[model samples]
Target: MEALRVIVDPPAADGGRRVWVGHETVGLAYCRADVLDFLRRAGLDPERVRLEDAEQIEWHGGGPGSWGARE
Candidate 1:
């Protein structure tokens, strides 16, 4: 199978990030687990996917450590 193109947008005013898989926007994720859930719901295995892998996920603005502006 082809690789999944995952893009996590910058945190919004509410600290939620928009998750995109390929050309579809899955949903807004507030935390790491939320992102995993989005992937899981998309028919991807959460355990097999690595959030830290740049080749797997394109995290904009900041990585998992970043959430809100206050952080």
Candidate 2:
């Protein structure tokens, strides 16, 4: 599976603190609902969170030699 990063910031009512997503800045509205839900469940604020690498790493599991089989 692939992943994408989006910075998040706290809402004005919550003091509106600056949040970083690996040095990048993002708005609160862009945050995902599922992420916010998890944060709330974990007693964390979604605004001050950083999303892991926006870029995806190549999966080499399907390539030759990956399965450890003999030719």
Candidate 3:
């Protein structure tokens, strides 16, 4: 089974942390409990998904001011 990666992004426009699953925006979570709840609602096992800090991920969008962009 391919490991699912859950990237935690910085707080977005909604003032809540954005969670990403493979370039798809799962949802915005205000806290750890909220994030877990979202995972459960998405039919994903919270324990199985590899949670990653946004800073550690290399931005593939490729543009100025992109998250994780290399200068």
Candidate 4:
């Protein structure tokens, strides 16, 4: 098993995904911009970090497209 630095958990009942940076839970992101905001507040540069980067983001149940429940 490997430790995920940026983990985006499966969507919740409220159609939001839990964004985790390291061991801290940033917030529940409902959209791509929300996720970006979490990363920005975590000290990650938005210009350098991309949401499509698989190596940088670990998406669980579903990727960015799956926000309104697990598909």
Candidate 5:
């Protein structure tokens, strides 16, 4: 099976962070650890998941972005 595509967006206008699996929004995370934890809890191997940044994906063809950690 294909590894899950995990897209992590920077904080939103409301200051809430987001993660996406395909077009579905899985959940909100405050930091990188939270992102990994959420994925583990959801039965996904965080290591196998592809993490992408929303901003980069929008401008750069969805290339790999930061690992969901707040910079």
Candidate 6:
């Protein structure tokens, strides 16, 4: 199984929050503690951004249900 990465893109239209996939050859998910620690290290506020679970992402549109009509 392939792992997925999640990230925060800050505020924009529609509350400026978007849930999307990211590419990182290093690990599956962005370590939560690491993000928190980074924010602390950078003297930033964790509240400025929100991180969701990205360890196990589900791609629900690639199975038989997605098959096209046969000629």
| RMSD of each candidate relative to the true structure | 1.2, 16.9, 7.7, 3.9, 5.6, 15.3
Best by TM-score: 1
Candidate whose lDDT is highest: 1
At residue 23, give the lDDT of candidate 6.
Answer: 46
Clash count per candidate = 0, 0, 0, 0, 0, 2
- Supply the TM-score for candidate 5: 0.54
Model 6 clash pairs?
11-16, 12-16
lDDT of 6 at 64: 14
> By how many angstroms RMSD does model 1 differ from the true structure?
1.2
> What's model 2's overall lDDT?
0.34
lDDT, candidate 5, residue 70? 40
Local distance difference test values of all predictions, in order: 0.92, 0.34, 0.55, 0.86, 0.56, 0.34
Q: Is candidate 2 or candidate 4 better by TM-score?
A: 4
Candidate 2 lands at a TM-score of: 0.26
Model 5 accuracy (lDDT, Cα): 0.56
Q: Between candidates 3 and 4, name the one with more favorable TM-score.
A: 4
Name the lDDT value of residue 6 in candidate 2: 32
Deviation in Å, model 3, residue 57 alpha carbon: 10
Quote the RMSD, in angstroms, for model 4.
Answer: 3.9
How far in Å is the alpha carbon of 57 misplaced in model 5? 11
The sequence of per-residue lDDT tens digits that candidate 1 reaches over residues 1-71 is: 89879999999998999999999999999999999999999989999998999989999989987888546
User: Candidate 4, which segments miss by more than 4 Å at Cα?
Assistant: 1-4, 69-71
Tell me how far the alpha carbon of residue 56 in candidate 4 is from the true structure, in angstroms, after superposition: 0.4
Compose the digit string of candidate 3's lDDT tens values, residues 1-71: 76456566665554466666666878866655667777777678767643344442332332113333122
Q: Write the per-residue lDDT of candidate 2 for residues 1-71, one digit (tens) a residue.
A: 32333333333343232333334433232223544554444444556543342331111222111222222
**What TM-score goes with each of the models?**
0.93, 0.26, 0.55, 0.86, 0.54, 0.26
Q: Which ten residues in a row have the lowest lDDT in candidate 5?
A: 55-64
Error of 2 at 52 (Å): 3.3
